[model samples]
Target: MEKIVIIGGGFAGLNLVKRLDPEKYRISLVDRNNFHCFPPLFYQIASSGLVSANICFPFRREIKKMKNVSYHMGHVKQIDIAAKKVTTSYETLEYDRLIIAAGSTNNYFGMENLAEETFGIKTVAEAAHTRDEILDRLERGAICHDPERRRRLLTFLVVGGGPSGVEIAGAIGEMKKYILSKEYPELKPDDVTVTLIEAAPQLLGAMKKKSRDRAVKDLESLMVNVRLNTGLKSYENKYVTFADGHKEYYETLIWTAGVKGEPIPGLPPETIGRGNRIIVDEYNRVKGYEDSIMAVGDIALMQCEAYPNGHPQMAQPAIQQARNLAKNLNKGEFRHKFEYLDKGSMATIGKNRAVADLKGFSFSGFFAWLTWLFIHLISILGMRNKLSVMVNWFWNYLFYSTSLRLLLRPTRFPLRKHWGD
Candidate 1:
């Protein structure tokens, strides 16, 4: 039996395996995580609109039906190309073929300290951590009596004007208006400030001009402080300095600026391109090895006619490429080269404000928001998870928000007795 080893088990890896036949190859999937996190709804989790369980699906549970595919929770340490084997934390994997689906990481733009200080929504655990961080600051504000401290603590600085940043800031904005109002009366809606900083002049620079204009308008309507043509240059403890000689002190900073590809060892430095992505041909195969090894998702650089620098590093492109590659992999080189289909892009501002740019048609406002919800709900894996998320969304729509908004405790605390001190 031929061994097919996959490095990462996210959207790309899982989607590739979905099209694979059991009889042809004995599949071995390796990931650092045990659960597959649905990336799209991570913002909902961070904003306290959804729970952790709603966004996380067990990969083992989902794929236990396939007898050929064996899932393992391990990290890939190194790959020995000459020996045709991989060194992992668990064991050495000798593979007949290799697929590198290792995804991207948050780009701090060379600012390492800022990366450490900021909270980014990349994984399930990061989302949970962001939620806890946001909640903890708010709770801390309720107890702190100092006016300046309260002001600093309540301010949330979201870096980048991309979909993730915009959506997160928007969600936090909604939490302030609808939910946080009913919960914390002491703090006014104005008290909780959500700042969105972008290096570009307009928000969602990837979208159309009309859509970008509408999105900026929608966000400004929600009173999200929009700073354009500004970048985070340097940072200390709580202070962030921008390129334009402007700085702000923020207690909570959510990073969504940019991302780079996951590290691949034992590869020549020349093959690596911008964003640390592995440079590959349009066939989704590594530069030299067209048959033996392949690359996909955010890590792969499929520079083509439409995308000279490779496709946009988004979930849609990754999933589409994976599905296409899987079919082509089974069929051989005679198969047509993969071309990305542009469905659309959306950014949700608060509860009712959203903008979507389709291939020809563009939409905004309440209807667009509804479309966004339905698309996300459908994209999520598992019937049980979809139903749970739908029900919770409806519940949130009915009631203002959750009454049980407590900061998640990662570790249990011990009982301490207080005498007559």
Candidate 2:
């Protein structure tokens, strides 16, 4: 049996592992974290709609069912293509075949301050941290006697117009509309603000024009300030300067602006393409070593006639590519070319407002919101997670509140005296 090593236990890697024939290949999965986190629901975690465990699954528990698979908790330091070896933080492993699915990281567009200060919802930990920060800021704002300082603490800015940005902005808006008055009685409804800024012409650039229009309308209805063609120039000392030379004071800034592939070291510079993704052929094989080394998911860029710029870095594309690569690897031959199926896009704005574009048809309103909920709930991995998320959603829908709004932090205590003393 051939020894196969896969890096990153993301949507792509997990799907690929499940499809591969375990009896014919011994597989080892490596990741910095020992859990697989669902990125789509990360915003929910950040907004206190869900807990971390609802979307995260332990890798060891998942791999136990596969007799031929083992889990390694470590970060990939380098990949030696010629030697066919993967060097992790813990140890080195030799593989007959290697798969790269390391995924992407937040792109700050060379803005150091934004990268350092802004909150991100890319991982479970980050999302949880963001939630705590938001809650902490609210708590401070409620007690702040100075009007200016309190205003700054109450203002929330989300930079990005994509699904992640829209969803999070909407979630925050919902909290302001429903939860703020009851929980933080000191702060009035008009005192809190949720602003969403998009540098592009419209939000959800990939979606249909109708959907984009609907998203903007829904967000505005929720009292969210939607700014278009607005770019961030700088963020310093709790103040944000826009490209138009205007400045605003805000304590909370959530950045879902962009993401770039985090390619592992030791690959030839020429193999790296736009967005720092490894250039791969249609068969999902690395440029130089098409036979042994393969790249899939967000880390790989395979351009075709339909997608000259490469497939959109999304969950569907990543999952599809992994399944396709697994089939080809199982056959021991790169017989088929990878074809991406565009399954359309959807984004929810608030309680009963959402937009969905399926093929050529577009819809918005409560029905679209229901569709969005159903799809995401079904796509989540693990039955327990699905049920937990469902219960949370149901409870939130009925009460307009959630019990998961918790600001978790480590507790420190003073040293205690010995029992003998």
Candidate 3:
């Protein structure tokens, strides 16, 4: 049996393992974390809409049934292409074939200070921290008599018009309307402000124009302040300065603006392309490489006529590419080139409101919202997760409440027994 090594247990990598026959290949899956997190529903975690365990699936449990599949939780430090070896924190791995599926990271675009000052929701840990900060700020703001500090703590600003930003902003808006109204009556509905600032003229720039308009309308209905044509110039503690000389104050700025490929070291510079992705051929094999090495998911830039640059860094393209490559590998010859099928895109804006562009036909409102819910429920990894999410959604809908609004703080920040008495 040939030995195969795959790095980064993301959507692309996990699916690749599923397609491969363990008996035919000795597979080793490596990742920094032991579990795989669903990225699409990360906003719900950040807004206390869903728990972390509801979206996480352990790879150990997943690969236990496979006889030849092994899981290693280690940080991959380098990939030696010439030697066909991978160096990690625990040990080194030599393989007959290698697949690099390492995903992208938050791209600050040379804004070092902005990256430090803002919050992001790219991972489960990041989403948990965002939730913690939100709960902490709300608790502190409720007791503060100082108007300036209270207002600053209550104001939530999100930078980006993309799906992550839109979803998070909408979740926060709904959180304030439903959760805060019942739990923290001391804080009025007008006390919390959810503002979404985008540099583009409209939101959801990737979706159709009609869907974009519907999203804007839906967001407006939720009382979310949509700021368009606004660019971020600088950010400091509790203050954001815009390009137009306007300044805003907020305790946290959820930066969902952009991301770039997370390429490993020890690879030649020529193998890298725009957006830090590794350029690959039609069969998802790295350029200039024969067939020993391949790249897939967000890190692979496979250019074609329809997508001259590359396909979108999305779940569908990544999953499809992984499955395609696995099929060709199983055939022992490069028989199929990857072709993307755009299944359509959708984004939810609060309860019973969403916009979807399905095969160029645009729709919004209740029907779109139902479609969004159904699709996401089926996309989740395990049955337990789907059921947990569904139960939470139903409970929330019934009483307009979410029970997972707990502030988890570090031990260093110990609470006083009697309000610092």
Winning candidate number (lDDT)? 2
- Give Cα distance to truth, residue 168, candidate 1, Å: 0.4
- Provide backbone clash counts, one per model: 0, 0, 0
Estimated TM-score per prediction? Answer: 0.95, 0.96, 0.95
Full ranking by lDDT? 2, 3, 1
Error of 2 at 175 (Å): 0.8
Off by over 4 Å in 3: 412-421
lDDT tens per residue, model 1, 326-385? 887676452867889988898888667889997789999989989999998888888999
Residue 228 displacement in candidate 1 (angstroms): 1.0
Look at candidate 1 and give me any clashing residue pairs: none
lDDT of 3 at 25: 93
Q: Which residue pairs in candidate 3 have backbone atoms (N, alpha carbon, C) closer than 3 angstroms, thus clashing?
A: none
Per-prediction CA RMSD (Å):
4.8, 4.2, 4.3
Evaluate all candidate structures by whole-model CA lDDT and list the values in order: 0.83, 0.90, 0.88
